[model samples]
Target: MGWFYSIDIIEGWLPATIWALVAIAMVVLLVAQRKSLKRAGLQIGIGLLSGALGLLATWLVSNVFVVFGVSLGWPVIFAVAAGFALLGFAISAAVMTHTWRRVVAIVLIPLALLATTMRVNAIYGEYQTVGSLFDYSPYPHISTLNLSLNTISVKDWNEQVKVKSRNTSNIPKSGKLVHVDIPNTASGFQAREALVWLPPAAFAKHPPRLPVMVMLAGQPGSPTRFFTASDTVKILAEFANKHHGLAPIVVSPDQNTEATRNSLCANTTKWGNAETYLTQDVPDWITENLPVSTQADEWTIGGFSQGGTCSTQLAPNHPNIYGNVLAVDGEIAPTDGSVDHMVKEYFNGSKSAYERQVPRNAIVNNAPSHQLMILGAGERDAESVSNIKKIGDTAEKNGWTVFRFTVKNWGHDWHAVNAVFKVALPYLCERMGLGNANVDFPTDSKIRELA
Candidate 1:
């Protein structure tokens, strides 16, 4: 099913613009009540404090429930937060008697409402906007190879990768985005459709084998989340158009099988065998079903948020499969909640097992050498930026070639994902030998400026 909505007109920019206008009106109202400064000031401070307390209470409650494996989805969480805002407004309004103070309370109520709407939009509005614009016309499945999973030998696969990597022409007009069900015959992964973004090269009459990027989405999100919000297909398309359709075959697999089930990308009895589903089943399906390069260097394991954490975890643990890793706003470890919660729920109450599953712990223990790693986050996403920088430094010290980047003026949102991809795709092109080695691209220009 298409997760995209066609209400961009109402839900995307319109509401956000209105909220900004409301904020401006609130400022004007505050200025109008400037004559009664002392009274207005006291009421405004109290109202703001109350609102903050309410939000803090909601966060505290949310964290408490997370330990019990109960996920209060964003909408419900926001509703609870809104309740607190109302309570704050009510309490503050009751104590104020002056006309200007009453007017300030009236303006603040709508201001709080507008802020809530703005927050919701910032978090999720991109999905609706892009989902609405996307062309989800079903494309016929295309597979250039007809081999069984295990039949292809190392010698032939290596030769094929070499041949396909050299071709620069014979590209199609555009690629296709299709829903695929990577059979979870053994792992019993929750039923969810994966998204395959086949580049124009994959659609040519005699399709050249492309490299593969097994991507994962954040928890409480689907594969379509990346497709709709980040414009990943568009990013790949631009890269392909520039380099004669040489782009990675990006497959965003379904990580959070159930709506509330955050498997933490592990092989756990409680959450299903997510690790097997991702590392083994995904690669097996790609190798057997698609005409994609199987050379380790040509392959990438990447994702945003939890998926990014999963990439760091999976790639290091299974270095023979994925040679390159791109993690955008990745967590430092694999976790359902706190370490204690992760241990209790998925690790059979074993702290050691929980520690072993964390990406940093696993990487430190395994110590894979010469791996290409990109650790990216938004400048505004302070925690993630800090985590990735620390992790990247550690990885580099351990003999890995790590590139750390931060997108300016973005937080932990879809725009950050797009920004990272902008730099990452070109870097991949150079690494995979898809484009001219000497010719610098605009991504290089951006990188220089960032540097």
Candidate 2:
């Protein structure tokens, strides 16, 4: 069963074969329903008409009135229209006289639905392997982390960052990812389990204090997605292996109470105080538990999509705590929909209270000195590219060192998330005093200007 569930759903011969089978079934059912040329014409006509209507509806919803908030693009729109046409084909065939024809039509329904889902996923690049679809993770999960005796005290922290050791004899072959429950002591914000990534260096007998990167997953996502969806652990390990096992400790903490819920990453009446959770509870727990650096310059907050917005919000809002920021495809501002009712929401009704929470406004207001922020999105994700540039422009104007990046051959999906992070990992490691990666990220120029 595990092997059966391990099939790759994103790209492979299996998905192609399924789509081919569905197409063959649709044609078979179409031909079997033909009582005569006249009857066959009627059936085909209805299916085509239904498909046209579906396509029109999708276009209107995606473009005209702005349903789903973002455009579904041509691929998704076509897949959705094909779904409607598949239903039309099934319904038309079900009215046939033969029981065999009806049974065939019935079988086509689920197959077509699966095909549509696969098509959309292929376009958006969301779910990769079949195991990811089932929420299967490949990391260790424990009740609690016992690091008190394993770690040195804050007072004993070395002035030099981790990876100072030239010897690699004691370093583990691979890093460790442990899922555990972080005590919500300060904010009392209800959140799911958090994930911690310890570099191979941390496993050594005399591990030096390492830098910290606090990661937040996007909405409709969880902490494990930071591992399963993106390539953080893999890229970090590669960097560590090259630089004598030096990598920043990455911690994934949940801000939202549920998977789909949006807490706006702000304190409010309707949703929990997610801002307080990240700023106070999360940091305090890390300071007490992890054997990592305590300086603000050694700490970074980063995320994707909604999580990215949270990073921008939290880092700028509390520069004294997080001196670095990495916002990948983050929103221009925290919003539920088109209109952001600042005066009537949270403080009055919504979670994102005022302009102060916005990255564009916050960057200038705080005026972080020599802070480095990286803004990135997929090359095809126009919305994110635009939003990040808007925010990055403000950061540049305010004297913040900003780097813009675009993930190639992907858009608004996990592939883009992984690509962006892979590039950023080397740069981030060097920033944390790890051995140089020889990465030149086109500082003082646009992302397109990168060689």
Candidate 3:
């Protein structure tokens, strides 16, 4: 199913609608062909059995790829699913004597329809069209500040400007989201172009240097995934609109160079220096180019899943770079989901060396810094929620300010990720010198607020 979505053709409502129509048409045809009760019942049973076989074949193939760490692209997955469907239909037809072809149609048609329906349901109202899935947030309509590159250095700008409170009555407009290629000079790594979301507050004539948030996406994910998957931009935009357009300058940099490769956000001898690329090159690029605040306390490192795990290590390990962290569904320790594989591939057969880079070990051995962090997971995601709790507890025990929360009835997906932002962004806003504008958001017992 994951691989099936990679194909752009089946992405929108059209395919889903067509599949549903085909399913309905097949059912009608099947009923017309087999009017007798005994034959109709047999046909329906055969059709359902074939559909089940098709579904099982699809699942088995997809899971086989996953278990072997071989992810098939959309085209391959599509072909595989089609082949299995055909095989299932043929088998069902070969067995049945009367109305066998109709049975085949009943099986394959409904199977395709159900797959499309589930996909549609997952992202129905989330986006308008399939194309909108990749579309960026609405750009700021209002005119922005004309600050030149030579106007002032980041250091001078931070020292001279006072963090002014935003006007509550007047709503500031949204900011432009620009895609900039940040060169990885520090780590000498090849990284994807970073996306920068400049809030409306950054556009004043004497623009206040907004705080910086370095956000990351999960493994097999891109930087823009944060925008497309979760309503991070929308949530932040709402907060900004209420608070006179005051929001942090969010820079989403790619953690993994490729979809399949998991860098583990480490400067290992195995893969590229992803840790350095993120902690150093990313910040250096932002400071040199963008008009953002450079204070460590004003800086935040955040991500979901693999990126979240990376944030935990990046903040605690490199306190001078990022003073705060947001880890959503983060692993307790950094691994490639396999300890032995991680040790062999990245750590060069050194378990102790690998353990040294883990967040718990790093935060424990080093003297506690005044860094603040939020660790969250979905309530339904028991294992992850439990792990995140341990990570948060460890941080709190080490004298770090940590807030832990759980998104009720959600699991480790974009919905859960959005929930984290909805609840926790207010806390982030207050920390970044943007006063909470009393934005009304959903609060329930599912959100387990930890001290």
TM-scores of all candidate predictions against the true structure: 0.73, 0.87, 0.76
Q: Comparing 2 and 3 by lDDT, which wins? A: 2
Our tally of clashes for model 1 stands at: 0
The lDDT values for all models are: 0.68, 0.76, 0.67
All predictions: root-mean-square deviation over Cα? 7.2, 3.8, 7.0
Which candidate leads the pack in TM-score?
2
Candidate 2's displacement at residue 21, Å, is 2.7
Cα lDDT tens digits, model 2, 124-208, are 7666678778667666764343343255432233322354444336457888899878877878889888989988767656565
Q: Model 3 over residues 1-451: C-alpha lDDT tens digits?
A: 3333343433465656666665665565456556555755665566556656655565565445354232222333444444444334434443553465556555654565555444533532233334434444333321343432333333333344345423222223676676767888889877876677887756554455678899888876777666666678898888777665677889888888875678889877777899889888999987877667788988999888888889988888888889999888777788775888888889788888788678888788765667887878866556668777777777777878877788765555556678787777887777777755465433322236422
Q: With candidate 3 superimposed using the best TM-score fit, by how many Å does residue 153's alpha carbon deviate from the native?
A: 14
lDDT of 1 at 422: 80
Clashing pairs in 3: none
Candidate closer to the true structure by lDDT (higher is better), 1 or 3: 1
Error of 2 at 279 (Å): 1.1
- So what's the TM-score on candidate 3? 0.76
Query: What's the lDDT for residue 368 in model 1?
Result: 56
lDDT of 1: 0.68
